[model samples]
Target chain A: MSERAQQLLEIADDELLLGWRNSEWTGIAPFLEEDVAFSSIAQNEIGHARALYELAGRDLGKTADELAFDRAPEEYRSAALVEPRFVPDWARTIARHYLYETADQIRIEALKASDDAEVAGLAAKIDREEVYHRMHAEMWLERLVGEPRVREALVELWPKALGVLGDDLRPLLRERLAALDLPEVEPVERGKHSGELAELWEKMTVVRRSVPGATW
Target chain B: MSAQEQAFLEYVQGGGQVETSDWMPAEYRARLIKFIEMHGNSELMGVLPEREWILRAPTLQRKLALTAKVQDEVGHAQLIYRVVEDLGKPRAACLQDLIDGKSKFHNVFHYPTKSWGDVGVIAWLVDAAAIISQKALLKCSYAPYARIMKKICWEESFHILHGRDVILTMMNGTDEQRTLVQEALDRWWGPLMQFHGNPIAQGDDPSFSWRIKSQSNDEARQQFLDGYVPQIWELGLTVPDPKLRKDEEADRWEYSEPDWAELKHVVTGNGPRTKGRLQLRRTSRAETDWVRRALLAEAA
Candidate 1:
């Protein structure tokens, strides 16, 4: 694969997996309105993933669905940060939401500066949607920042949050955290898979695998 | 009835609309709340079955569509509960009643969704059945509800399309896929028939007289059959009822009597999946209790 294609797959995989994790709260979110709002965000993440996969698929000669769902778990390039399941835990869910949006904003900003016009254009479009996502996450962050449980959850997930960013973007994330008076933690860098991704892949691909060579 | 309530009834019967702030009889208000609350509860509970498939959706497109569809249902629940809240009960209380089995939702929701095909059938047929009743609500005497029904019906149109697309794709695919759709249809046919409720004369039903429901139970059922049976038949799928057919000369459908006993049994919280689904609702509510408290505290 071309370097551009590989780069796109990494970002796309992160989104696909993160979207999958976020959707786990579809019906059972804390309240009705929030349930609807959060589900939209989940759909948005997957949508962003699909757009990215389509762009990447062009270079790899595959369809977006194939790129998104057909890859082996070992071939998945998602960050460990987006791999864990967080249903029924609003604290950690929000903690992850706030952190991932922060990290994704940084990454998208860099992609928006890419020399490839198509990549740059898609990045710009994704950044437009992420604006609301950021607002939502920041809104929750402001509300829960004063709570001890939220603070603990943020602290607990801080390392994983750092893993979502590359070394170049990690400094920017740290700067943002420092502005919010958040303490820095050791980074859990990307490039490794946990058992969590394998489990998610199992459920995600079960239906598609059941009837091989069938269109759904 | 009191002279005041008698006047209110006659006004509604004569096609008058009632606003939330308008004068209404005590019985009218109570009846409105109960009916609307159950509709809201059904929308909320309806999410559980489809949510499972959102994870297992075969393609990214299917996954996105299913997730958005589920999201729309939750949105519908929110809009519905707001109307109910205006009527008297709070949204939280409605939810509590739902999980406690003190209230009821639609019969179809209480059953299990066994496969990807069930998802398609539900979106196509179950939603088709629901849209029939909801369309009747467009002429409801309660102005607030009738207004919201317009938006709800508009969104339901897309769900039916999505469902038909899913089913059609499966039906056109491999033999295994076709079998999946057929089996799902077989399992769902009973609930779909019972969906509009037992056939009752419009004059005998209180909901119909109040103009809360402008159509009779059998009227809604006939509408559903007229609209969907051909769609089902054209796909080479059987209706699972040997007696089901259109009576052209009589201008009505002739079918075996729906199992009213089972409809009552399932909706009363004894269906195959009701206990497990409600238990999930109860547990999730308990787990999120602190989140609501903390968030509300901050807002206050």
Candidate 2:
């Protein structure tokens, strides 16, 4: 794959997987208002994924659906941080949400500077939508900061969170964590897939694969 | 009825709206709480059947659309439960009643969703049926609920369009895809027909007497049929009911009567999936109980 296409696939995969994970909380989020708010964040992530996939698809000569659903499990470029199942666990979910949004902002900001106009334009659009997501994540992070369980969840997921960004971007993530007074941890880099991704992929692709090439 | 109660009734029947602080007859207050609480419960429960599909949505666009649709339902529940709270029932109590099977939700939520077909059918037809009932509630005598219904109806417009888009896409695709829509329509038609509730004479229905619901149940059902049946037929799909058709002379759709007994059984918590769904709700609520407490503690 071209460098530009590979970059798009990596970010698109991360957003798609994270969005899928976040959407699991739709009906079962801790409270109704949060359920609605969090679901919008999930939808936004998926929307971001779709745009990114479309951009990549233009390069690969495939449709966004083909990119999103028809790929083999190993072919996906999503980070491990986004691949876990976190439903019914508000603490971890919010922790991941908070961390992911913070990291994603850095990535999106860089993408906005891309030499390719299409990538830069899409990043600008995504950044506009992501404003609310960052606010939502910050709100929850503030609310849950003092809770022991949430603090513990943040501790647990910190390394995975760092995996969402590349080595070049890792220092920025670390600096942001330092600003928040969160502890430094070794990064869980993204080359290897998490065990959860395969399971998630199985469910996510079931309907599409049930009738191959059929419109949903 | 006492003079004051009769006056309140006459006021509502004459199309007067009541605010949260207004003087209301005891029965009106109680009935309004019960009626509105059920609507809230139905919206919450309605999320369950469609949520599973959120994980399995075939395309990114469909996934996002379905998530937004379910999100809207949850948001509607919040709006409705807040209204119920103002009417003297706490949201917690309403949720407790729902979890304990001490309250009712609409029957459509009590059933199972078997496939992607079910997803499209629900968004297209179930939401269509719901929108009809909701449109009628625009003039609800309770100002708060009527106000929220306006937003609810506006949001629902996209759901029906999204649903129709899904169905139309499948219909225009392979035969198996089209079959999915037809099979789903077959499974869902009965619930759609029964969704508006068994017809009750406007004068005899307490909800109508209080102007809580402006239209009769049958009126809502007819509106759904008139608007959607042709859309279904044009797609070459069949509703499960063999006798279902519009009567030209009566200017009404005539059909084999929906099983009111089944409707009662389902709303009363005996449908195929009711027990499992309630259990899921009970368990998830317990799991997240601390999040609520944690937030409340922070607020305090």
Candidate 3:
């Protein structure tokens, strides 16, 4: 695969895994209204993944489904930050959402100027959807900002959030922290999968692999 | 009814709407909660049957569509329960009552879905049938419920298109694939027919008297038939009701009487999959109890 295809997969795999993680809250979120709002965010992430996969698949001689589900656990390029199953925990979930969307906004803005028109175009489209996601995550962050536990959760997850951005992207992400007056930490950049990735991969692909060659 | 009740009845009788804070008779309040509560419960329980498919969906398109459909159901539950919550019941209490079987959900969700065929048929005809009743609810006497219905109806529009797309793809595929659609439709027709509930005359129904439902049970069922019977026939899938027909003369549909007794039994927590579905809800809730406590506890 070309350099473009590999870069696109990293983004797609990150989103696909994170979207899958977020969806685990569909029926079991903290409350009903918030559950609805959170589900939409999950759908948006998956939708972003689909669009990204389509862009990458053109160069890889495959379809989005093949890219999303046909890969082995080790082959997936998603970061550890998005691979955990953190249902029922609103603080951690919201923390991760805020962190990831913030990190994603940074990366997507950079991609928006890609030489490849299709990749750049898809990034522009996804950024539109991510705006709502950022607003939603910020809403919860503001709502819970006064609480000690929530504040602690946000602090604990900050480094992992940094991990989502690249070494060079760290400068931009650091500026975001300086604006918030938050203390900086070592960044957890992409490339390494978490221990959680294996478990996520098993469940994520179980159903797809169940009946090989049969149409859904 | 007394003079005041009689006057109130006349207002709704002539198509009046009520808001959450509006004055309502004791009977109207009770009936509205019972009726609307069941709908909220139905949306919540409804997620279980369809959610499994999200885990097992064959293709990327199918997976995303199925996930969105299920996610919309969760969103609908949120929208619905809020209406019920404003009606004097807390959502936590409603959920507790649901887990305890003190409340009810629709009968269709209480049954099991066997294969991908069941997924397509339920989304196609079941949601289509449901949208007929929900469309009627857009004009419900209660204002808050009615407003939420607008959003609910808008979201459901996508489910129908998604359902139709799924079923159509299967229908146009292999012979076995077509059979899946046909067989699933055959099994679902009886439940879909009985879904709208026993027909009561317009004047005799309390929900209609207070305009909680702008359409009668039979009226909604007829609308479903009038709108969808032709759609079904075009797919070359026969409904289980052999007597089904559209009398262009009456501009209405005719079909065999649904077994009202069976509907009563199934919806009252005795359906085939009711126990198992409820058990799943209970288990998941229990497992996740800490999340609510962790957040709510902090709030408290």
Candidate 4:
């Protein structure tokens, strides 16, 4: 794959997996208002994934759905940060959410400066939507600041959260966390899949594979 | 009724709308809270059956569509609970009543969804039935609820289309796929038939007497039949009611009397999936209680 296509696929895979995980809370979020708000964020993530996949699919000679659902588990390039099932675990979920959105904003900002106009333009659009996500994350972070569970969750997920970005972007993530006064830790970088990803992939693709090539 | 209550009733019956701040009879306020709270509860409970399918959606589009549809239901619950809250019932209390079996939701949601075909039938037929009733609610005497119903109805239009598309794709596919739709229709037909509740004289129905519901239960059921029975038949799916037919002379639908007893039983929190669903809600709510407190707590 070309570097550009690989980059797009990595981001797309991250979003698709994260969106799927986030959606597990649709009907069952902590509160009704939060359920609605979080579901929108989940949808937005899936929407971003679809758009990214469409861009990557063009270079890979496949359709967006083909790129999204037809790939073998090992072929997906999503980082491990998005692979865990955190349903019914709001503290950890929000910890990951806050961290992921912060990291994503940094990555999206860099993409906005890409020489490729399509990538840059798409990045700008996605960054616009991420504004709300960041606000939501910050809102929870403010509220959960002194809570021990949230503090503990942030500590546990910090390394995986760092895995969401590339080596060059990791320093930026570290710098952003420094503002929150979170201590630095060894980063759990990409290039390794959690067993959770394989399990999630099986459920995600079951129905599609049931009637292969038939429209759902 | 006192003269004050009588006068209030007359105004509502004459198409006057009530605002949240307006003086209402104690009984009127109580009934309004219960009715609106149940609607909110129903929307929340309705999400459970379809949520699993969002995970197992066959395509990216279906996944997005299902997620959006479920999200709308959650949104509707928020809107409705807000309306109820403004009427003196807090969202927390409403949720409490629901979990404790002190409240009720719609009967259709009390049952199980066994297959992908159930997903289609529900979005298509069940939502079609609900939209018919919701359209009637656009004229509800409670102005806030009526306004929210407008938004709710608009979003629901897409759910029906997405549902129909799913059913059509399956019906037009292989034999097994078509059978899926047929079997689902057969199973869902009973609950769908009973969805609108038994007919009562509009004048005698408190909900209609207060103009909170602008149509009788039978009228909503008839509209559902008029609008959708043909659509179902066109797809070669049977509705499982042998007696179901439209009476051209009276412009009414005649069907086997839905088992009111069953509807009563199920909605009273004894449906096949009701207990389990409630437990799921309770467990999830308990697990996340701290998040609510932490996020909503006043700053120190």
Q: Best-fitting candidate, measured by lDDT?
A: 1
Alpha carbon deviation, residue B281, candidate 1 (Å): 0.7
**Clash pairs, model 4 backbone:** none
- Proportion of the native interface contacts kept in model 1: 0.93
lDDT of 2 at A83: 92
In terms of DockQ, the best-performing candidate is 1
Runs of candidate 2 with Cα error greater than 4 angstroms are A179-185
* Candidate 3 chain B: 10-residue stretch with minimal lDDT: B288-297
Comparison by lDDT, 1 against 2, better one:
1
Q: In candidate 4, what are the lDDT values of residues B1-300, reduced to their tens digit? A: 999999999999999999999999999899899899999999999999999888888878888899999999999999999999999999989999999999999999998998888999999989999999999999999999999999999999999999999999999987778888999999998899899999899878999999999998988888899999998899888878889889999999999989999999999989999999999999999999887776557543
Model 1 misplaced stretches (Cα beyond 4 Å): A180-184
lDDT of each: 0.92, 0.91, 0.81, 0.91
After the best TM-score superposition of candidate 1, give how far the Cα of residue B228 lies from its true spot, in angstroms: 0.8
* Residue-by-residue lDDT tens digits, candidate 2, B73-186: 999999999999999999999999999999999898999999898999999888999999899899999999999999999999999999999999999999899888888888
lDDT of 3 by residue, B1-300 (tens): 888888878887787888788877888888888889899999999988887666556676777788788888887887788888888888889999999999999879988887688899889888988999998988888888989889888888889888888888777776777787888888888889999988889888778878888787888889888888888889878788878988889988889989888899998889999999888788777865655666686678
lDDT of 1 by residue, A42-70 (tens): 89999999999999998899999999888
True contacts kept of each: 0.93, 0.97, 0.44, 0.87
Q: Which portions of model 3 miss their true places by more than 4 Å?
A: A88-92, A109-125, A138-216, B201-203, B242-257, B283-300
* Residue range A84-148, candidate 4, lDDT tens digits: 99998888898999999999999999999999999999999999999999999999887786888
**At residue A160, what lDDT does model 2 achieve?**
87
Task: TM-score for candidate 1, please give it.
Answer: 0.98
